[model samples]
Target: MNNAIGNSMYVVIAGAGHVGAHIAEALLEQGHSVAVIESDMKRFENIEAMDVLAIHGNAASPKNLADAGINSANMLVAVTGSDETNIIACVIGKSKGCKTIARLRSPDYLREGVGTGNLDVFGMDLVVSPDVVTANHISRSLLLPSLVESGELSEGQSLIIELRLSEGNPTLRRMLGSIQLPPGAIICSVSRNGQLLLPERVGPLELGDRIILVLDSRMLVANVETAFGVTKGGGTAVGGRLETGIDKIVIVGATKTGIQVAKKLENEKAMIVMDTNTERCQHARDVLEKAIVIHGDATDSALFIDEGLGDASVLVATTKNTDFNMLSCLLAKKRGVTRTMAIVDEPELKLLFEQIGVDMAVSPRMMTVDFILQNILGKQISSTQTTLHGSGITVLEVLVKDTLWMVGKEFGNIKFPRGAFVGSVIRGGKAIKPTRFDTIMPGDRIIMMAPQDSLHKVEKLFSYHSGTWRFR
Candidate 1:
């Protein structure tokens, strides 16, 4: 039995900022008792108003951990702004017999022979770097064709693709069940008019609805786009020409994310970086082998025009300020950059920025939560991935056991639980787009989506144990 299953854990979280606050709320919603410690009194008040047990104090202080009931807590997550404080808090939490996780931004702590795997010596069970997670997500998003935001689904073998509906597509304005998608394609989540939906039996998809699709192989993505006319440059229903793969990449901001993006793309494309801070720009120039560094404000139209932003194939805004990132993307789009991406820290801004024409909006806070949750909830069924914006829907992969009654049974023979359905199946290294007549064989790898609450039910349905294999 999993340690966290059935038992509601006492989870103590340090820091009430964007990442920490969101994690606490999610843990509470999952039936865990949560207490948050924030040094900033104003932030503490904000979190306290949300019904959480918010304490105002230094998390690194033993007295604060005691006040939060660390002695009785099952887990302690330190996501404070200062890495030193987070490390110290974990050390204290460990001494109290709590499982500890620390969230750090600097890579120094993760370097070899440094703070890497040796974290166990310091009482930290896991060290999560949001910067690395955000960087990887941004890199994957850049590789997506037609400007879609893509994430790893099924341990990087499958993908969660976010596509905006283009006009006059056959897949639009029809109930999901009515549409015939390509093999291995599943429409799992929909973001329509600012509402996030886990469509169990969803209605017709609307024009401009941002939909997320799970594909066994990303190669099938172009087929869906072609069938639906969805493209980054628009034109189908969005009313703009489709943008192609990027060649010239322009990044605004010299923060760690910007530097990481520049380094990732420098070898394959012509990279240019712009930042207001001269010292950071110089450091980025020195660190990146071939990237061109420009000392200028991203929000300044004059700077962009002088830099010929219009000629760039892709523009990425990585500044910490959400408003600045939006403005920079707008300027880039106005200057004829076909694709624009922004680094947005807040989840609420993701849809808003996309609505205003930003092609992609990556969030560090959301990335951090997905990592923390996956760690807290160990892999049992298979690998799980968060769809766009950390929507409650998750794509999972599991092996079908021969002992299960459903094995060798037609897909129609089983009734999937609410908010869940099989998306794809892999057998003998070949991917299959499952149909009602398709029979599930033992040892097949099946991909499915379900709400977090329904995951256990889904898992039970796929278990090989004769007791669990029976139809409910």
Candidate 2:
């Protein structure tokens, strides 16, 4: 039933929603041969024409699948608006002898699929639930400073980690070889300033050097805290790790996302939520259950002092008002909070968080974009995050695929876009801030951060790769 023709594997996407388009864009940009088969004719016309092959058709029907050439297609991702359409598309793709992936939005499928009798009946490779992925990312990112990135692989046998050297980081100006990586950790790449860099044997790591590493599952949180210069000791940085944690956290807003932030924590950290609305603050209190909710202004210094806001380990400002969130986080930082988080939705005000001294600025919109890109795109883009200031940097957690042309090269040999830096690498379960000695491997997950304008240059890291990445 699957009769598709292409020089190599072709990916067929069966939806044109926000997430589907994002996936298509990424695949097209990363040079993947993707045929988007959207049922909506009007929406199909709106799909961006930047080098992607767009075929308007319905994959839900068997006839349509045959017409769309599903026989030779490698992978089929069903992400249409209707769950029935997605499942039907997957079933047809499987019948055509192609690997199948379906976006299962219902939590029922997520909970019952594995043990629930019949998911294996179809040729399902991976089933993604957006809420689960989004919640997981949000919880993890909320726990650490913006400088460190972490990922899980192989059920704990291996990991991918990224570290960004900030202006005030204690590891600044140190020789790459001098710092000892954790046991079972390997460094992958170093992003210095905004360039993907390969440091010399004697090169010293200055502030703002970004490092990506892979580590063994046994690594503890205390070790991570120590490695990243956190005041607290021994706990890992994944889900459920921070709840048993004994640090204090203050969230300066009572929005829905703020509630999500609190729900993610499973630790004993004292949480105080502050908001201007009496009812909203009360709702935050009731919803958090374990947190102390204060109905007061976040910008008020006296209130901050009285509530011990400055003494918290982390301060998260998730107010809808970007300006207020940034300012509140700055206030907390000045009061000596160790870590801070702020949610800013505006792309234009990206610089405000940095200028205002917030430790990290998060945008749900951008994160949602990355989440949508995960399933529809063929490229192995694990996750994407952007860091502010220091020349408009962006970090992409991309799986190294065989189609990449720049594979098996040392960091120093890779040509980065001007103003881009290749910081450090995570290899074999350890962090290696490479001194121009490390090499890229097949299974390696590379974390590269570069200037916002230099993303095109960063893509050159895979100049010869076939899979497309719709980079933002």
Candidate 3:
């Protein structure tokens, strides 16, 4: 089996739902062969239009798995809506000597040490949960308050933050090369007017340009906000006197995602969870100790006034209904909520919701795709995280090896491909801000950001093999 992902390999995906179809599309774009097995006729027809072999049958059936060529498949990903089907399909794939990835939603299967840790009971290489991934994304935004989107890298030792240049931002209009950022921070990419620009190619920062930054996780949030001219007060982005903690947060839905969000923030911030379903509300009440669970409609204007929701610093809509989530967020904004977030089922609608008024829109399917892609691409790379909202840029953590060509080269001498940038270097667990004169050393882990097309070149630069590589 090849250890580098730069080469193309055959991949089999089960269930051509949103998650599965998106993963197939991404793999095909990366020059890999793909086949999808979907049980539903409509979904099968939808995915059959793509450049893949589409089979209509139960993914859990061994016959269907055989038809999909699982014996020759390099990897098998099971992302059906049913957890049992996903697990069974993965077991079949694993028995065929194929790498297996399963997307299971039940918390029982997602415990900390079940499939990971010292146990390999699941016979799978990776497992992902859409609810947990989406919940974590929402919680990070609420905790940071100032960042537009945020994610952790290198085992939480580093952070990748996206922030828009507001009107009062100090870095606005400054040349990208001229700004004096914090000691361990670097601008990785900028999204201006719908164009993704590398920091070196970008000129002066403009208003509304979304910039992605890579920095040490220990750096103070306030310092990053100050560097960008964003003011936070009372744990909200609206300027005021600085407070010690987050303000009141209102979540509407009482869903698994909603309950997870409340649980994550219950100890750190005041939480209120509201839903029209009395059973779900009661369930949330039993599960959460600090959150206030209410059995009522969040869209009800009377409930907003009765619960004093206008004082909430943030409002999140996590229901399954897309229109309801958007409407609920708009109502929250009308009630004077400082910021509003919604869970968008359709990835394309994310930008549309943000443009209308929603502060942030997260897609669970997109999150799942990112998680799977990170695992699939982890054969050679140490770790990976992509920018939310489909910016086409990815952050990678790579270990420098003595067998690689650039082991003893200076940062200034190597000609890095276009759209690729080395952000920082970690030597002996300490982050070293990269300079033109710094020398690449063995065992050093380098943090880099690049687009999908340039990944092969980036991988070649750090690959252990001398001539060629394939990762699957």
Tens-place lDDT per residue, model 1, 1-472, is: 1123333667889999988887787666555688999999889988998756778999999998999988888788999999999999999998888888899777777763132233777688888777667776777766664536666654567666777665656577777676567877777557676555655545888876767776778787767766566544332443344444477888899988888888887897889999988899989978999999999987677777888767887889888888889998998888788778898877767767876788778777877876776666443245443444334455667666666667788988888888787766766654666778988887677777776677767766654243221100
Q: Give the winner by TM-score: 1 or 2.
A: 1
Alpha-carbon RMSD, each predicted model:
6.3, 7.1, 4.4
Q: After superposition, how far is residue 68 of candidate 1 from its true place, in Å?
A: 3.4
Consecutive 10-residue window with the lowest summed lDDT within model 3: 234-243
TM-score of each: 0.74, 0.64, 0.81
Runs in model 2 lying further than 4 Å from the true structure: 3-21, 33-135, 145-176, 183-198, 201-221, 224-246, 275-287, 295-297, 300-306, 334-336, 347-352, 376-472
- Which candidate wins on lDDT? 3
lDDT of 1 at 53: 76
Q: How far is candidate 1 from the true structure (C-alpha RMSD, Å)?
A: 6.3
By lDDT rank, best first, the candidates go: 3, 1, 2
Candidate 3 residue pairs that clash: 4-470, 4-471, 5-471
TM-score of 1: 0.74
